[model samples]
Target: MKRFLSGTVPRFTLTFFCLWLASLKLIAQENARKVIRNIEIERHDVFTDLNRKPRFIYSWANQLHIVTRENVIRQELLFKSGDEYDAEILEESERKLRSLSYFGEVTVVVKTEGEAFVDVLVTTQDQWSTIVAYVFEGGGGRTTFGGGIEEFNFLGLGKRIFSEITHEVSEGTQIQLRYTDPQLFSSRWTARGNFITGPFLKDYSVRIIRPFYALDTKWAYGFTGFARDQTRRFFANSREFDRFREEKEEFQVFGARAFGSRFHKRRVQLGYRFSTKDITAVPDRMVVPLPDDEVSHALILTATFENLSFVEETQIDKFVRVEDLALGNITQVSLGRTGIPFPNGVKRFELRVIRSEAHQIFDRQYLFLTLGVQTLFEKNTIASFRLRYYNKFARRQTLGINIEFDYADSLEDSQLLLGGDSGLRGYPARAFTGDKRLLLNVEDRIFSSVNILTVQLGGVLFFDAGNVWSEETSINLNDLNYSAGFGLRLGYVKSPDSRVGRIDFGWALNGGGFGIVVGVDQIFSVN
Candidate 1:
């Protein structure tokens, strides 16, 4: 190869290309794709980086089998049996499971095996939890404190359920119930049954959400669905209670997502979704003054492109992304919610954030363009930072700072905030937000399990700080209002992460001993 390059190119060019190819392409090939049937992994070869990322290697090292139904993978596992080719199947399963943060431990066992005909045993870690959780809200002469019982494994059938009740001095009682089946149709889909009736959305909302994922030779795609129904009196009317009436609203939504990543060069994340209500059958008067029925149907769509470059020789990571191209420069919208009644929420922010990380605006002939530059940075950190100036003619302008951090690239204390309820644990699930506000959470976590099986206990010290401000107030960063205190978090995490999470018990100090709070899903993270 060296001889050929030398003769085919100028001496200087050949030298430069060779070095470039070695530093970049050498590391790239370490993650290049392979035919599924090739590069089999044994216990000793489990950690090999060839054809796989390091995380997959760590997951595969603990892998067991590949559970499938009708040729579709149901879940990934981390256990093995003497009768099955556990190593191989587990590796493939890890590829699918990592995309989702809803499982604790997912393993496929060989139920009954003979020759090439193997019956896969799908086993999931149980999530049975007993939790007392709480929340409080009051900005305009109203404040409430409440808590409830939340559980993960309702009946040992891998089904999850959570029920909670809370109260405020004058507001009222809040009750919620929820259940979900991670594998609704065995593979490629999920469903949830939710019920809620409270002072705010003072209505019962029952909705089903399903997500489908698949992959071809090149890219992968996923789809999700959300449908809900709301009842009347979902809100409080200061004057009515004796003869308060009720109304109902039903709606449905569908969303699609697609992603593609090559060896180690670039990654493309894109998707679109549209939702509308079928309120034709409802009576006009049955609708409350402002209900889902009275709301307009809308559609949301977004697309993003990102490129990554790794200079292994120097161990630096440089990548850039541009998200939510549908509405350029829309920096203040959030859409990750299934029924938040907004178009392109999380998606648009995702695109803009991507661009902010991996791209920069450049001009050369009086025309400005966003150039995504991929290069190595200090200490080999995988960084996506964006520096942008609005004007095409002037270099002096307002700068937008957007940077995303990934611990997978960390070389040290990075992992300190990577595990358990550490970073963003203020209000589990990163739920602290405000306009021109400050969000902060400090948790000192101590975990002790009852012999690693029957039970697990965790104690936490937390400081939750942040506040919401109306447009009427003058904004000041130095004078950001915040609340500080400590709390305890206990988990009934049976099949945590790759397993299935059932109950998340969170109670913090809201100026008192313990304020009960409940969190949904298994992935309770902040970073």
Candidate 2:
């Protein structure tokens, strides 16, 4: 190299040496400047740009390796760029997938695909697992209750295919079978299950999620056909006491039902429900109101509408989506667990009440009114009106104190409620056998995180005051009963990273033994 630079007698070599020395000195001076800057830049949080800041952005890549049930790689998913330091974008995409609530865990890692690009890698959680459960009950209506078992798989054959089967043998025998397809056929058609169970006899039903609907939530609709053959018994003594006596005649009914619901950002709709029944084979000797008519089947219609909004301009993420600006003073969720046929001796006594703008309050008070219609066609249909009020109690959540008076020819029925599992403890389900039932459960819940899991243990004082009577004011004190209990509850949250939280509560009665109930999702199953 010096030879090439030399002009004569190594003149170029001399010149090259001089230039090299000058350049080396300049580099050394630059290094010294850097060292001096580092010494003066002691981190004290005074200037954040250069103190304790993220170094190099640590660019990463996103990768998804999906395989078959047999661990065979099928395909991989990639975003626009391979290795990029867009933490916000990566986190957002990962969050969307995690919201499915189907995985046990998920992590995103960035990898340098090229000089300035990165890809992401998503690692999924565990797969299908086996689960089992057992329950027992002893009550006035019947005894000899036992337990049951259950098993299901969330990821089936590399897709969202699930199935569950449960059986119970107690006062009677009952069995349930269900299969769900997260992505039905081609769209979001969620196929339901078929159930074969009964109190006194057996019944069968098959349901499906119908396509070709309206609205974005047109995710699915349910169409079901059910048939049941059973008999009703008479407990001659007390109206509250149900004696398991066989009926004189055999009764059969074939029915079809359809259900639809709509869900939005803050609104929930029980959409609509329509059911038609065809009844036959009523023995002539039975003591039915329409004895001579042979008691044909009746059509039933059920509908519900609900809308929830936040008083504060904030989003609330109780168990799922959590935002900084959201205020979640109250958290509640309601869904139908199962449906039952209308109670016997009920053609003219239907309870109806409507509430409008009861949550919003002004001048420290809010009120709503509701009315009911009686006897639409026959003595089987009766209606009533209701009114409710709310006031600021302490926190942002309003104190829900409402009044409802249902006027009906009768309130005698054996039909249960949707969320009956989380109500009145210390008593067997369907324990309250009466012509009229009134219940109130007021709760004040406070939440905190314990051991990384959101622990929501609330204080609930409940009072169940009701009377058993053949008619109004004819109620007998001997049959009248009231129960008050306090509840200690633990709530489990639904998360994409961790297992969904569980809620289990124990309630102690003033005059009864404590009751312990631990179950999934549903609040209660009390009748």
lDDT of 2 by residue, 85-118 (tens): 4454445434443334333334455543433334
Question: Would you list the C-alpha lDDT of every candidate in the order shown?
Answer: 0.34, 0.35
Candidate 2 ranges with C-alpha deviation above 4 Å: 1-130, 136-153, 156-170, 198-201, 211-222, 231-376, 382-422, 427-431, 446-448, 451-463, 474-481, 492-527
RMSD each, Å: 16.7, 17.2
lDDT for 265 in candidate 1 is 23
Query: Against the true structure, whose TM-score is highest?
Result: 2
| 385: Cα error in model 1, Å | 13
The 10-residue segment with the lowest total lDDT in model 2: 35-44
lDDT of 1 at 332: 17
Clash number by candidate, in order = 29, 40
lDDT of 1 by residue, 33-146 (tens): 322221212222112233444465435433432212222223323232333354344434544543332233434434554434345554332222334456543222234567
Best by lDDT: 2
Q: Determine which window of 10 residues in candidate 1 has minimal summed lDDT.
A: 313-322
